[model samples]
Target: METVSLTINGKKIVTEKGKRVLWAALENGIFIPHLCAIEENPLPFGSCRLCFVEIEGKKEPVASCTEEVTDGMIVDTRTESVLRLVRMAFKLIMSRHPIICRECPANKKCALQDISREMGFKLKPKRLPQILPDLPVDDSHSLFTYNPNLCVLCGLCVYICNEIVKEAILDFNFRGFITKVGTFKNRPLAESKCNSCLKCVEACPVGALSRK
Candidate 1:
């Protein structure tokens, strides 16, 4: 395979050409804070925006998951500006996302929680007022529950359903602040076209979709 040379955190490395920056760093044992990234998924989902990296000559840090590695690129995985943006983004996400970390089953397993801890954050709800209202949970499926309150809208479930599973049973509804992943026509999972694959539940980084 073709290769490209790049520098990440001042360490020079060579990776496959056209590979995503996040994967390149990770392939070489460099951890760039990220969520919504699964190695099996071929496409990049830049929903989390937590994998921001400062590329030299760029005015702002770009989402590493979507940005491809180019030859001679200089990347900084950790910078004050990158950390600040990540924290701010997490704060906003956590404000609307319910924080029942104490009793939550995914407390230790959640990607958001992991990133928060890595950033030296407490994972507490910030003072930012929520723009979205709480929604009812969907436990119609026999195998799992769908809790919109805990959803970070990372679209991993939807991606797995549509692309990986090829069922297209789960999808987004509404728009803007009201957007959410749901069954077609607001139907329940059991009643929808879901094939009981349980891929969506496994793809969820948080407890938004959990086994029942």
Candidate 2:
């Protein structure tokens, strides 16, 4: 495999050719906040919009998850502009996500919590008014629960279900702000004929899916 030389946050590194900046940074112990990155997936979804990084010569920051690492590339993961963008992205995700870490299953293990801690951002958004979703929790599955209100719509579960697990049992049910992960015809998990693999639950970044 060919290797590419690059500098991330002023640290010189070499990664496999064709690797994305997000994975390269992560593999080298450099953290770029992200949630919607699955390295095996051919195309990064970039739904979370949390992995913004500034590359030399670029006018605007680019999502590290979707940006392929190149030889001689210089990546800055902590630029002022990059932090501003990442902070806003975190805030936007928090605007809809309920802050219930004390009561939530994910709690300290949650991706949002990790991002908040790593980025020095608060869990609650100060600028945007919280628009809490009133969706009921789905405990129909014998092994797990689905809480749409706590969901960040990172799409990891959906991608894992359809692409990795090949279950095709879950997907985004609606459009826009009302969108959520759901079974076919909006059926309950018990009626969806899910095989109980629980990969989706395991892949979920937030506690939207959790063991019962």
Top candidate by lDDT? 2
The deviation in Å at residue 13 for candidate 1 is 2.1
TM-score of each: 0.91, 0.97
The collision pairs in model 2 are none
Worst 10 residues of 2 by lDDT: 40-49
Give the TM-score comparing model 1 with the true structure, all chains together.
0.91
Among these predictions, the greatest TM-score belongs to: 2
Mind giving the per-residue lDDT tens digits that candidate 1 earns over 19-102? 899999988888777767776676767777788999999999999998889999999988999988888878778777767887
lDDT of 2: 0.91
Model 1 residue 196 distance off true place after TM-score fit, in angstroms:
1.0
Regions of candidate 2 where Cα sits further than 4 Å from its true position: none
